[model samples]
Target chain A: MSELLHRRTVVKELLKKRGDMVVIGGLGAPAWDITAAGDHDNNFPLWGAMGAAAMIGLGLALAQPKRRVLVVTGDGEMLMALGALATIAVQKPKNLSIVVLDNEHYGETGMQRTHTGYGVDMAGMAKAAGFARTMNITAQKDVLRLRPLIDGMRGPLFAQVKIDAEKLPLVLPPREASYIKNRMRISILGPEAALHQ
Target chain B: MTTVSKAAKPAARAAARRPRVAAPRPAPAAPKPVMPAGTSHWAEQVHPMLVEAGIRQVGLVPDAGHSRLIQLCEADKSMRIVRLTTEEEGVALLAGAWLGGEKGVLLMQSSGVGNCINMLSLPVACSMPLLILVTMRGDHGEFNAAQVPMGDSTQAVLEAVGVLVKRADIAADVPEMVSSGLRLAFNTFRPVAILIGQRVSGAKDFRKLTQPAGDINE
Candidate 1:
C-alpha cells in the first residue's frame, strides 16, 4: 500500500466549514466517519441501503438548488452505484459534491478489498461522466487544496480521497431513520415543517 | 410528518407546455405522436396528476408494462426522469427528493418490486412520502410462469413492509386510485403503492417474443 491517508481526517476537513450544507452519509464506515466528525441536525446518515448515497445527494441538490449538498460514501458503497455518477453529472447540479472515502475495502462487511484497490480510478470515471471537478487525493495538502473547490467553486464535484485500510472505532449515528430524517427536516424547514402540507 | 414545498404555483400548466428538464435525449428516429390503440391510458391519466401535485422527479426500472408511462415522462419536459438500473434506488432517491422539498414517484413492475423490499424500510422508518406505481404482471392469464410468484405476492409483501397498497385493475379507475395513493403519501407522510393490473396492460404474446425457451433456464 502506498502511504494510505487517514479517512477521519479527510472527512473532518471536507466538512470543516459545512455551514447549512445537507450531508448524506453512505451506510457503513462513511456514516461512522460523519458521526465521528460530529453529528449535526443537517446530516442524514444512512443506517441501511448500501448504494444510495450519491443519488440521494443529487435529489437534494435538485430540490434545494441554492443549498449545497454533499454525499460522503466509501469505495465499496460508491462502486455499488457508480451509475449514479452519470445520472448526477447528467442533471449537473452546481451545488452538489460527492466524496468517496476510499479505504479500498468494505469496512463494514469485513475488510475485503474493493475495486478501487485493484486500480479502478473513480475520479477518472467521474471526469468521464462529466463532473465539473474530479480529483483523487492521497495527500493532506491535496485535500487542503480540494477544500476550497468543494466549498466555494460552482460544481458537480466528485472526489475520491484515498485513506488507510484499517479498522477504526465505530461512531454510529442515531440508527432511527425517522428521528434522523425528521431532525434534519426540522432543522432545515423549522418547527412548523411537519405542520405545513 | 409533513413538508410543504416551496415550489411556486407556476401558471396553469398545459400538457403541451414543457416547463423544465431540457430534452436530454437526442430525438430518437422521428418519434410517433400518437399513443398506440389498445394501450392502457393509465399513464396518460396519471402523468398529469403527478404534474399537478408538483412531483417532478420520476424514477424507474424499465418494464414493458410501464413503457408508455416511461415514454410519457420522457416526452413531458415537466418531469425529470432517472432510469435506474435497479428498483431500490428509487426509494432512496425519492426520500432525498422529498427531504429537499420536492415530490417524486417510482415506477416499476411486480418483479422489480421484490428488489425494493429491504429498501422499503427507509421510507417506512423515515415516514418519507413514497409514491410507488407498480404495474402488475403474473396475474390474470400470465404467459410466463417466472413472473407469477412475485406478482401474486406483491401486495402482501408491500403491506408486510408497511406500505399501504391500492389497486387499479381498470383504466377508468386509474386516476382515482393514483390520486388517493398520492394523497396518502404526501398528506399523511406515508408510503403508498398503487398496483396497475395486467388486465389494463393486456398479456404479452409469448409466440411473438424472439427469445427462445432455452435462453433463460436456470
Candidate 2:
C-alpha cells in the first residue's frame, strides 16, 4: 500500500562490507541486483538456473558451516522452486539465509504479474516449511535490521522483502560461467584447489 | 600310398589303445553361477566407494534401489545428506558444494532425470564436477508404463546436456562404474551420470505390490 523499497538499495545494504560470506543470486533481476551491489569473487550471481539459488546456498552452508551463506532471488524464481524451502528446512543449515526480492511481477518477462502480485505470501510459506526465522520486510528502515540476522542469526532464516516493480538498468556479472565458478573457487579454496576447472 | 596308409594305421591304433582304458565319465555339470547367499544390495557396495572418493555432501531424492546407500550416507558422520524435494535441486546443490571446496554426489532415479534437464546446464557451463548415480525404473521387465519414456531417454537426455553417461547392467559392475564415473567427473571437472540398469536394481512390480501380502506366489 505504501511506497515499495528499491531493490538495488536493499541489495547494497545487505551486501555492504560482506566478508567471506558466500552470496548466490537467483536468475535475472536478483542476479543483476547482487552484481550492482559489487561484483566480488565471493558473489556467484547466476546467469541462469532460475529456481536454484536457495538450494545452492544450502549446499554452500552445509559444506562450509562456519561461513555465512546468503541467497537473494526474485518472487518468480522463488515460486518456481518452492519445494526448495521444504528441503532447506529439513537440512536446517544454520549458516544459510534466503532473501526474496519480491517485486510482485516477473520483472524480466515484461513485468507480468506473478503470484506474489496476487497476494501470495512467501514468508508464510517459508515459516510453514519450518524456517528457524521468517520475516516480511516492507519498510526501508527494516532493511537495516536484516544485516545482523544474515550475519549471525541462528538460521535457516527466510525473508521476503517487497521491492518496487520498476525495471532498472542491468548490472551484469561475468558472462562465462566457468570464469565465475573458478574465480569464486580460487577466492574460497585457493589456486591449488581451484586450478584446471 | 603305402607309407601314408601305414602312418594312419599306427595313429589309429595308438588312439584306440589310449582310450580303451575305459571311457572316462563326463565331468559332473558345473554349478550355475549365482551370487553368494545373503549378498547385500549393490548400493551397499557403492556407499563405501563414495566415501573413499571423498564425497562430503550427498543430495538425494529417495529411490527404492538407493535405499541402502541413502541409509549408509545418513549414518556416516563424515557425510552430509540433503534430501531434495525433486531431483533438480541436487544439480544446484552439488554445484554449490563444489564452490565451497567440497565434493558432492547426486542420487536419483531415471524418471527424475527429466526434472534435472534445465539445471544440468549449471554444471556444464560452469565446468563443475558433478557425479550422479541413477537407479533405472522402466527397463528390463518394467511394470509401470509411466516410467518408460524417461527411463529410456535418461542416457540420451543426459548426453545431450553434455553429461558423460555410463551404465551398470549387472550388480557386480555397479561399484566399478560408479568409481570410474566419479573419477571421470572430478578429475576432468565434467558432469557424469552412471545409469544403474533395472536389471542390476530390480524394477518395482506394481502388480506384485497391489497383491495382498499372503497372495504373493513367491
Candidate 3:
C-alpha cells in the first residue's frame, strides 16, 4: 500500500496557481481544506448540501464554460451522490474537474469507515460513468500531476486522491450562504448580475 | 367490460357527469394577444417562455408529462439541457448556475420531489433563484397508487422547504402560471415551484396500454 498524502498539502498544491478558477468545496473537511489553502472570492465552499459539490461544479462549468471549475470533495460526500458522476459524464463539460480527497473515513461523523475505506473506488465509478479523465493519486508525487488536470486538462475529469484521515484543526469558511454566493457571483459576473440585489 | 371506468371513484364520476355552467363575462374593448389559444400544447408555450425569460441552463429528470418540453429544450441551441440522474442534483446545479450568472430551471415529476428535499436547503439558505417545473401524477386520472403519496404531498413539501408553490390545473393556465413563477423566482431570488397538476399534464392510465393485445392463451 502506498503512503497516504496529506489533504491540505494536496489542496494547496492544486489551488496554488489556480487562475480565475471557480472552486466548489464539498461539505465538511473538503470545504475546510480549500478554505485552509486560501479564502478567495471565487471559492464557493459548501456549508451544507453534503452530496452536491460535483453537481454544483457541473452547473458552474456549464454556465461558465470558459472558466475552469474544480470540486474538492471528500470520499464520503462523493459516495452520497455517486449518481452525480453519471449525470456529469453525460454533460461532458470540458472545464469541469472533480477531486475527491479520500480520507477513507467519514471525518465529520466521528471518523467511521466510509465506502472508500472498504475498497469502493471513486475514480473507477467516474470512469465507468464516462468521464474523459480519471486519476487515482496515492502518493505525494502524484499530487503534483493533478495540478495540470485542474488547471488545463481538456476534461470532465475525476480524481480520487487518497489522503490521511488524521484529524486537523478546523479552517472554517464564511458560514453565511448568501454572502458566499453573492461574493462568488460578484467575482465572476460582477455586481450587476449578482443575486438578491 | 372496461376497467378504466371502474377505476374512477364514485364521487368523481358523479362530479364529471354534472354539467358545468360558467358565469358569463363581458368582452374587452381591446384584447392584448400575448398568449396562444387555450388549446395550445402547454409544453410548447412553456418552452419558448423559458427561452424568452433568459433561462440558459435546464436541468431535468425525465418525466412523461414534460417529455415534449424536454425535447424542445434539447433542440434549443441557446439552452444547455442537463440530464440529471436524480432530481436533487438539479437543485444544486441551478444554484451553481446562479453563482456563475446564468439562469437555470429544473424539470421533474412529483416523485422526484422527495429526492430534492434535503438539497433544497442549499437554495433556500442561499436565496438562489430556483425555478422548478413539476409534472404531477396521482391526482385526477392516475392509475398508479404508488405515485399518489408524493403527488399529493408535492406542493406541501415544496412549501415546507421555503419554496413558493403554484399549481396550474387547467392546461391553458400553465403558460401564465409558469410566466408568473419565473418572475417570482428570478426577481425575488426565491425558490419557486410550478406544479403542473394531473388535470393540466393529463394523468397516466396504464390500464389502456395494459389491455391484452391478443389472446395470450392462443
Top candidate (lDDT)? 2
Model 2 lDDT at residue A137: 98
Task: Judge the docking of candidate 1 as incorrect, acceptable, medium or high.
Answer: acceptable
- In terms of TM-score, how similar is model 2 to the real structure? 0.90
Model 1 chain A weakest lDDT span, ten residues long: A188-197
lDDT of each: 0.85, 0.90, 0.89
lDDT of 3 by residue, B1-218 (tens): 74555557787788887868874586764322223456557888889999999999999999988988998998999999898889999999999898888899899998999999989999999988899999998776688999899888898899998999998887778899999999999888899999988776566566666768663322
- Ordered from best to worst lDDT, the candidate numbers read 2, 3, 1
Candidate 1 segments whose C-alpha is farther than 4 A from its true place: B1-40, B75-77, B209-218
lDDT of 2 by residue, A68-140 (tens): 9999999999999999999999989899999999989988888899998889998999999999999999998
State how far residue B63 of model 1 sits from its true place (Å): 3.1
User: Best TM-score goes to which candidate?
Assistant: 2
TM-score of each: 0.83, 0.90, 0.89
- Report how far off residue A181 is in candidate 1 (Å): 0.9
Residue B205's C-alpha lDDT in candidate 3?
Answer: 64
- On DockQ, the candidate that comes out on top is 3
Model 3 residue A116 distance off true place after TM-score fit, in angstroms: 0.9
Q: What are the per-candidate TM-scores when only chain A is compared?
A: 0.96, 0.97, 0.96
Q: Write the per-residue lDDT of candidate 1 for residues A1-197, one digit (tens) a residue.
A: 55778989888988897899899999998999999999999999998877878888888887788888989999998898888887778778899999899988888877988898899999999999999999988888998887688677478999999888879899989988888888887777776854486
